[model samples]
Target: MDLANLHFQNPEAFFLLLLGPLLILDWWWHAHKRKSTIKFPALAIAKKAAKGSKVRARYIVPALRMAALCCFVVALARPQNATEVEYTSTDGVDIMLALDVSGSMGTLDMLTRTDQAKLGVMNAEKVLKSGRFWDYSRLGYAKNVMAEFVQKRESDRIGLSVFAGNSYTLVPLTLDYGALLEILQAVDDSSASGNGTAIGDGLMNSLARLEKSDAKSKVVVLLTDGIDNASLVPPLHAAEVAKALGVKVYTIGVGKKSGTFLAFQQNPWTGEISWGEQPIPAENSLDEKTLSQIASSTGGRFYRAESKDDLEKIYSEIDGLEKTEIQTIAYARYQEKFYPWLLVGALLILLELVLANTRFVRIP
Candidate 1:
């Protein structure tokens, strides 16, 4: 039975002051209205008539009226019981998304299956001619899948990073999923300003962004295909930094078993054509083994994303993995019922008026 009240401040003691003035005014007015008494004949007959009447003997009527007024005033005070509850809210993970925008990610290799290639004998012939090729490059596929992933996670605070030859924080950790998707959709292969990959730098940049987050869990989802070809700090060292800061790093390897060729065009002289071909060995391209080791060292898992669907599934899994607990406190506010107290005062004044005009009437 906890007692509390609602007002501009504590108001439980205010009622005592309110009724005091009225009681004093009533007592003073009644004490001053005394008149001289006159001898009356047939007093015995009057006393006999009063004996049979059932009217109140004392001030029962006024006392009953005061009791009713007290009830209404207490009700207006708005008493409430205060309590505290503890519950877990599983939605409080803060994440930083480090995306690989390296030049090699532009290599086209992901293939899409269509119904046109599922028909009959003609379909079989077309399928044979369809050669295994991807319509979009790895970077483009990543953009599409990440856009969807950001839209699905509106409750969590997320940040974005783009790394290639150099690393930069494009969007700091935020809960604005729409803005994050807008940035994702706007990303193009041209955004890979650096010609090389800096996986270590990217991881370090992500950790820096998450430094200010005071959450129960902090994590980084680092997606890269190329090894750290250009970085002052090594990828393994960056992973160690993340571990020291209590940040988990989930590594994603995006590409195929056998990496594809990265294509480029160069023009020399006005309108002169200069086309060349070079095979970037798939083995030296993306260092998945190192990435897996980094993730394992930081109590996180590594995932492989070879296509758009694979990328989406990887993000879905990450979304389910990171979570937080939020506890919300709810209670009703108390309001002062001074208006009802004043109303009762008005009723009492009105009752006094009626009594003076009829039952308690006196001849001036």
Candidate 2:
């Protein structure tokens, strides 16, 4: 709109505008040779456009096309208007999420409902007695909960590291949460199943992601349902590395001990519950002592996610970590202003096309 400040990125493209005059002259010469003269001040020509005869409309189409050509030439020139704007930025922490995918995580003991312990036990019973696999097992439940945790940290750079018998980085630290979530959703669909828990491998792999991160605060959230039975590096050794790197490690032990799956039922009509508890098997633990030490050594707390609610609560606590912030200075930037010209050119060409193909169709 401001002709005084109009800028064209590709000013050389305006040479295309020269074709408009030649096209109009060629059309006029043909019309004059046929003795079909048309006068114009285009405003007057448009006044009679709807009632114009087919012969008269012939001349109008070429002029409409020429006008469209001129508009397009302006668009090709890439006109823009530069304006100044201000912006502010914030510093967000770097995080790595390490999840366990060991065979023990396939146990149908985690809850997807409230009053987790009772519901968790009841749900496990239903899945077992009905002979149907609970697709949302310990790992499944963890993935679902962790997806929500990822969404809450929008400004931060987060990565994911998975471990079963071994550990590897699944996604590197970045701000692209959308792509991260899609990859996370596909973890169970793949055949990357593992048989043992390598907590140290997973933790160390996660720490490696933040090795070069320059953020003021770095953190790792490690969630697992099994003990570290297969790792070359001990979990404590990884914790020491994290402490030295000034990265906090929040360790979470999820699901209950193996062989402790509970059984309880309710009468349909009486609504009375009954317990058929078997003799509790010797506890198969997640080695909570080691997990706690790893967390404490890295200046972070250990959390026990005994049920679905507990798991969600643990993540909620980690989400409350101290956030770092720094002010950004305001600066000037340029914004393109050629969109209107391009849109106008496109609409004019479309109108000319519609008119020629329908109401102005030539018999020849």
- Top candidate by lDDT: 2
With a 3 Å backbone cut-off (N, CA, C), the pairs that clash in candidate 2 are none
Q: Please report the TM-score between candidate 2 and the true structure.
A: 0.57
lDDT of 2 by residue, 203-313 (tens): 999989998989888999998877888898999999999998999999999876544553455668986655443332344467899999999999999999877888888
Root-mean-square deviation of candidate 1? 8.9
Q: Please, what are the lDDT tens digits per residue for candidate 1 over residues 194-272?
A: 6788889999999998877787789999988778888768999999999998999999988776644433334545643
User: How does residue 54 of candidate 2 score in lDDT?
Assistant: 70
Candidate 1: deviation at residue 357, Å?
Answer: 3.2
TM-score leader: 1
- 149, model 1: CA deviation in Å? 3.0
